[model samples]
Target: METRSLGEHERSTSQSPRVIALANRAGAPAGHVVLSAERISKSFAGVRALQSVDFDLRHGEVHALMGENGAGKSTLMKILAGVHASYEGTIEVDGTQAAFTGVRDAEEAGVAIIHQELNLVPELSVADNIFLGREPLIAGVLLDRRRMVRAAERLLERLGVAIDPESRVAGLRVGEQQLVEIAKALSLRARILIMDEPTSALSASECETLFKIVRQLAIDGVAIIYTSHRIEEVLDLADRVTVLRDGKRVVTAPIGELSHGAIISAMVGRELAASDRGAAVQDGAVVLSVRNLTLDTLGPHGWRRTLHGVSLELKRGEILGIGGLLGSGRTEILESIFGVQRGWRGGSIVVNGETADIRSPVDAYRLGLALVSEDRKERGLHLYESIGDNIALPSIGALSQFGLRAFARERALARGMVRQLAVRCTGIGQQAASLSGGNQQKVVIGKWLATEPRILLLDEPTRGIDVGAKQEIYKLIFDLAAQGLGIIVVTSEMPELLLLSDRILVMCEGRQTGLLRRENATEETVMRFAAPGMAAWPHGTAS
Candidate 1:
């Protein structure tokens, strides 16, 4: 698969002349080497992060760097971008030896990196953040706010995104914040670009826009180092891929030379079996039902209705998937049902056939409902806190005896959850930040599971985790469903939703457009109803 098969995007833009130009740096031919790292070895507190890793990028190439979490992918990328200055290695830029002392040095050398974790200041406007330290000056004195905002708008337009330049980043959603981050990177106009899991927070529609941008950049001869867990997209976009496993480069070849199995095998050092979607369990009684779920928010333009009479049902032991592009009210539906979404205008929630007036998370929790938020670092976990402390947060009251805390009970419960989830850690006392992406996600899920909820709501259940951990979590969901826990999963990945869902509920603009049986759920069918104006799904049903 290649960008040609991604379909033609009509967007076309001319770069700003006043903004930093992104010409062919080093005056090299299209296929000439632009950047290289030889025998790069790094360590952290005595642990070897990378073992003599070697990688190279060309003038007009989309090189994909791949590996599981903590497999030395980030370490090598950080070394290249000058984030890790203490690494032992030789870096060459444009056939000349170069040592970057810091990120500014790398940027000055025509290199810019977009980290997987967002690095924007929430207090600043989108335009301010885009040109943070390099804000243009009027006559080299006054801040050129007009030029900065215009340039930012052009960058957003080039990416086909509709974010306002004046809007503060704090008010934006995770996906929107990610778009801002990309815009910030593009504003640099660097010849060498590195993107780490750029699409982890983007929606299907936004991803299309980004793919178009990437394709255009490649045609313009900008070298890009793209990293992603979504192998399918990599197969479509990258010209070559370099697989790193446990800190060493296993293979570097043209994308066409390797199959999906080959990539997975190289990453984990084993052939992984495809996930089997076993037969759906026998029907269980309805556990949750929502009717006329309406929500409104006080935006700049007064009150805007985000949810429009969305309705759904979850039965015991069944996994119901909510599928949609970003801002389609997928997360809002979950939050509203969990009594977290703001300004609930009208809605009726029925749990176990009883009408419930749930207004807060505590009320929902009391009724045996738990929500695992999409962002683990910010909302789900205390990164600096110990694993045992995090898992025992919600259940502290229940684990206590009178006014005194039951330390032994907390440790016992944490140990049980850790063993059940297979979280690899030194001990329960280890800080959550010390764990890998997969282990951190497990802790988030485990903490919510400790609440012992009958209904579970998971948003982006496997976002930013590796393939191995994804498989384990998939199996765990099935196992939990089999034990009669009703689950609702909100995911942007089509294949994941299809695999884990017993029935798929498609949403568009906050409206429930289609309800598909597991057998009827395909990528094409789901998109038919999920995308607005894909011709109305006449046969679509809510029942």
Candidate 2:
């Protein structure tokens, strides 16, 4: 713990003028450090999450935080946002020492955080979620519906999105939910805003809108602390960059003071080799086949056909990619084959020349098939459970004897899977919730890998992972394909689909638009096929 006298604080406030501006917008006044964290150190279960790290924000600057998973980026953000109260540090706001006891204390001090993981109640309306705890009252006894809805609408409009304030959050898409979280942060009107992976789920158009809003906010004097893995966005939006690695600050410099290669080297301590373009496989036999795979989806009106006549053939030792924009039935295709019904799935799947009648996940596992879902936290891993338990969950029944759980067998399998995936953790007893985003994804995949499935399905395999972790996953996927596993990947990233897939099956509006080989699939080609009016409707059916 550290303490500062009033005289010392006043002396530190008078800093040299150094204006940091965004492109085309006027910069904030220099020497205006709105929030500052000095000598912050924190530990969890004897593991150092952060160690004497320092961070500061200007009055109207977009300061980007860059780091790999488990690099103390999230830990430092949590400390500054008041999620971790007990830490060896001193925080200051406007040259005054402040100790935030909780999230409320931080909010009251004009500081707010928008977490990577969304923090909205799914059952509540969009307006209700924005004004959750601090609701507007009509007469000190009744809820102020009109005021809240109007305020929510204003926030949504400011972000340039068309979302209904009255709509339930559960009905919105993942990207929409992310926007709602941003709107909630805007409602606070905080002077210091911390955003973690804000554009993870955003579409291209949505991202354009968000960047505009962020630039406008900076012009309006809202100091922003931005965290993201997207290099181009950080280079474009951030006025200054601060990188952390393994609980220590690597560097802090203006955006112009660093280059692309320099930033990657600083964060990873090494140059990341680019992935070579993999050629299409034309040798292996067809391990899986789906002809006219169709499924129903529960939309706003009623059950609608989400997939129409979607057919693809995946060969042994091949990486087949499913490419499409959001809501283009890319996920529904995998869900249909895995028997995870979106709305009464109707599809035909043949595995290794045999039909697979998968009615549920258990049935899919039994039929030599496994699926790694997109939402790892909600659908894949049990957060609070141990790594060993999560890894062995799918096959625990087979390892049991006389209806008694075989704890020893479970640990052995978990350890083997952990070794195979090169997961970074303390031991098998570590909870999945405590792991980084990349490690958590590995656990989810390991959970299904225990089933010894011949076919694997991955959805958004590296959504929020850092560059270093992404390289590891790419190598792991290549290794799995080399081991004769038929793999299908669903990804929204065009470059990833082009880099990893042997062949891409492009879809548009729930219809198969085109099948492009490795050399033929470019960003332009993929987007052209993914656009509307390219795919014909199945016979007489309508969406």
lDDT of 2 by residue, 77-157 (tens): 888888988999899998999998998888888889999878989999999999998899977988989999999999898
- Cα shift from native, residue 20, model 2 (Å): 9.2
- Per-model TM-score, in order, reads 0.87, 0.90
- In TM-score terms, which candidate is top? 2
lDDT of each candidate versus the true structure: 0.85, 0.85
For model 1 the TM-score comes to: 0.87
Clash counts for the predictions, in order: 0, 0
Candidate 2 displacement at residue 506 in angstroms: 0.7
Model 2 off-target regions past 4 Å?
Answer: 1-31, 138-145, 153-162, 277-283, 344-347, 535-543
Candidate 1: count of backbone clashes, pairs at least 3 residues apart or interchain: 0
